[model samples]
Target: MKRLLAVLATATLLVQLGTTSASAAKPVRSSAIQWMGHSWWPRSVGGAPGPSGLWSPANATVDAEGRVHLRITRDRKGRLVQGELDTMDNGWGYGTYRWEVASDLTAMHPEVVLGLFTYGADPAYGHREIDIEASGWGRTPITWDYTTWANGHNPVSRTPVVPGRSTHQFEWAPDRITWTSWDATGALLATRTVAGADVPVPYDESIGMNLWVCGCTSEWRKTPATEVVIDRFSFTPAG
Candidate 1:
């Protein structure tokens, strides 16, 4: 009888251990925290940036001064981790999406692509993505690129990004998307409007901001860590 009782106790402990293990593997959820009047959630993903990359929630934070800061860091496992945030809710459409960037764009890491734009899951409704990226493509002379993509067509406009704090904007309207950027002293750096078939209808896309390694070249396989700060992000509805 004693041997049977011991076996039952062991079975009960095994079940409890299984329950604890399942709970520990669950994903973390953040819904109460809001930044810049928008609910943003950080990603914890792998299998990106050529071969592999990680997005750590700790690498994305908002300061007491109300600035959004994104960084690339290393995890406890010695793997490279970066910051990427997306709005929790979708359908921010047909308006002016603007941000004030505090990072100096003249000097940036060669493999880094600082992206601020909209993304959609479905390819049929919207174009799936629009990007305002600051990248050097793993080389010198980092510049800002306004890219519009739809139906396998991708068009990009490159422009110089100045030093100090600057403002960037993309106004999505009925049939066009106008992109603009300014220098620290309120001087316009770039402006262009993209229309025609490549323009998306702003159907079901959400805002996203990420500081990630560029997969455009072989540089994504290297080790690099950096950060970018944004003063604010605002949206003005179309009139």
Candidate 2:
């Protein structure tokens, strides 16, 4: 009888241990985002029905048929550059975002790009910024040039995503920004702060993706048909 009782006690202890572990596991969360539009970029000029970056008018709307296009070029020495113009103006713009990188990716070189024309002229908004480039080989590191001004200066924050395979969530709020990355079993790899900056003035100017071809030399090393696609994008207002 004592032996049987001992066996029952061991089983009970195991059950309790399991229960504790289950409770210890962290929870994962995703953002509440709504899709505004869906568009695809073509690898070639003639492959799809789209407007070339050269033809982007004063105000343009990206359609569902993969028609919106940006002109990409290689310099004399072969480098990637944004075409001739900065298409973002009054009506053309981008919304703010909260994002999370998937944890399952062993390596990711995530980047956020904003389009502004400043080729021969002064920097856009009279300032420049480059922050947070992580975990990619041979890719451009996160970098930007910033110009300071009076009253309220520009400030920015970069959020680092953990390295592992898991689904993560990102939320951008005025008071605080939240991020969570979890594994297949829903174990949190890392949850932390996202880098941000405060605008000195009211920047009502629009933002979009723009680049000049000759200004960049990195294209020589990259292959053709190398197009960067922003798979998902959205915005959430501060509360």
Candidate 3:
């Protein structure tokens, strides 16, 4: 009888252990990266195939469900260039969404392309783009603009982000129709009122590239290739 009780107790313990392990494996907020395949890799514009500068795949990776993983890194000369193509129907077509970039902006260049979305009227309904162009200057901030063939404009906002040491978070809550930014310390840097009226949703919009580049004013620098380091990128439903 004692041996029987011992066996029963051991079985119960094993069952409890299994339950606990399963519970611990539940999907966490940060780890919820969907696998996005090669469909999103960037394509060059000209005959050379790619932008005027040079770009290549990094330590970044992708998964099965079409979620992408990337680590943005600088080159030997403290420069980097990387971008991905828009392969899926991003939230811009319709619906509310949020995007987050956990970035370390040190003594880098004076320019960055955090994210972009195309907005314009065309049979293509495609070539339009919204840009979050940032310069390394704090008080000068960065710029956000939406452009199209028929109608387009550039609007600048003062972000006052400190370079050399900072992790920043940028968010867009379309339901609220506003954009917000916060520092690593959770301090609000700037807030801009965005409206469906002001920035109309592109009917078939998509997320293209958690991208960054060196030139904000011109094409690539004097060099043929430049690169930047990206730690990771994530997108979630924005309230």
Candidate 4:
């Protein structure tokens, strides 16, 4: 009787150990909006069918390492699905928003757009926006564009996309907004600044990050399914 009891106890211990090991090996996936204090787009709001794509909570997740992964793919109906996370409230006056791109933006399909921007369009407050968009079209060269839009003035600057892991940032001030791209080693790849009248004035808007397909461009619609991984995102209030 004692020998049988000992054998059963040993078997139970082994099972427990195996369960622990398996749990440790699996990455934990959590909601990106809840973890990062952002909101999923196009769910309750009505808008045009293409730019925002179809946002799915299942498409946005935070891995075990706390990195946010935004995936873009197609559903069974051949509809393009994407991921988007936006802040809950306006960023107020001036501040800096920074995030890291874990995927190779330069290698993405031309139709794919990784956007970091401030969005607001209200007639009472006037429209205001600032954007840093990275896009590629099939085998063509990838490009990054920094754009600022207001009621009357909208300016854009284009540059070659930087490949590999990199940090991208946008610093918004009262006078100017600066968009910068840097590699993993902290070496700056490109910088674009919009100043004077082109800068977006004070308005109520939330910062957002999205991985979506551009439907307006006919060639962009040809891109295959892809993903965009984000290592981190932070906001620093301006002094």
Evaluated against the true structure, the overall lDDT of model 3 is: 0.37
Expressed as tens digits, the lDDT of each residue in 55-147 for candidate 1 is 777777888998888988777776668787767666778889998999996778777778888875545533347778888877778888888
What C-alpha lDDT do the candidate models reach, one value each? Answer: 0.70, 0.27, 0.37, 0.62
Worst 10 residues of 2 by lDDT: 25-34
Candidate 1: TM-score? Answer: 0.83
Off by over 4 Å in 4: 1-32, 36-46, 49-53, 123-126, 137-139, 151-155, 216-221
Model 3 segments more than 4 A misplaced: 1-39, 42-81, 90-92, 116-128, 136-151, 163-176, 210-239
| Distance from true location, Cα of 149 in model 3, Å | 9.7
- Give the number of the best model, judged by TM-score: 1
Ranking by lDDT: 1, 4, 3, 2
**Model 4 lDDT-worst window of ten:** 1-10
Which residue ranges in model 2 land beyond 4 Å of their true spot?
A: 1-95, 98-199, 210-223
What TM-score goes with each of the models? 0.83, 0.34, 0.52, 0.75
lDDT of 3 by residue, 29-123 (tens): 11223332212423222111113243334423454533344433446765544544333233344333333333454333444444433322222
Instruction: Let me know the TM-score candidate 2 reaches against the reference structure.
Output: 0.34
Index of the highest-lDDT prediction: 1
Model 2, 103-127: lDDT tens digits are 2223322222222211111123232
The CA lDDT at 72 in model 4 is 79
Candidate 4 TM-score, C-alpha based: 0.75
